[model samples]
Target: MAPSSNTRPILLIVDGDPEVLRALAFMAETRGYGVIGCATAAGALADLDGSVSCLVLDQNLPDVPGVRLLKQIRDAGIRTPALLMATSPSAALQIQAAAAAAPIVEKPLLDESLFQQIENLLAGA
Candidate 1:
């Protein structure tokens, strides 16, 4: 099932790791989504031009924390649905992400859960 070109979901992925970013981009593209991959917060922010349907952010970005970036986006009035990916095994980070109303997908994301989550978000939107 190819994504509809007229209304295909756009996903913005912000992560510094090339490997992870590539994997996520592959997953999204294979699933018929339009993916905008950014390696920095600045890059992601630059691409947030209201067309994006969802954000997939990395918690351990080299420039700033993923949550902080998310906050900045929210402050700027971008209410796109977001999923945070955490590289560390920190329960506190997970709690913080939950408190911010964003779902957390652990690094080295295994199984089909992440894909399912993305599908659900797109379907809901």
Candidate 2:
């Protein structure tokens, strides 16, 4: 669907790493998405609402794990698409996230792959 002022795709990025957050923000904005960057899970949770179309969450955050946060959001009935970014999550953690239906994205992130995932998610939405 064509992005309009009232329907622009909103991507919420929850990561504590400054460089990664900046890169993700630049990539999303360049692709015509409205990017919202938060350094903590608390911040992202606070901002979660209908406006956000997707979430790019870091696996390890100062306050909470990404999988836990995803569960919280799901329990709250917010079914926005989610991508979990991690350097290397445990096998059990990965399984849990998968069961929750959130996709995983590896860290040291590749721009092309990341963009492709974002595009696919947005398009599917």
- The ten-residue window of minimal lDDT in model 2 covers 110-119
The 10-residue segment with the lowest total lDDT in model 1:
116-125
Q: What is the C-alpha local distance difference test score of candidate 1?
A: 0.84
Off by over 4 Å in 2: 1-7
Error of 2 at 95 (Å): 0.7
Model 1 C-alpha lDDT per residue in residues 60-115, reported as the tens digit of each score: 88899999899898888877888888766488777877766688877678877677
- Candidate 2 whole-model C-alpha lDDT, 0 to 1: 0.84
Per-residue lDDT of 77-98 in model 2, one digit per residue for the tens?
8888888988887798889888
* TM-score of each model, in listed order: 0.88, 0.89
Looking at candidate 1, what is the lDDT of residue 109? 86
> Looking at candidate 2, what is the lDDT of residue 41?
87
What candidate 1 gets wrong by more than 4 Å, as runs, is none
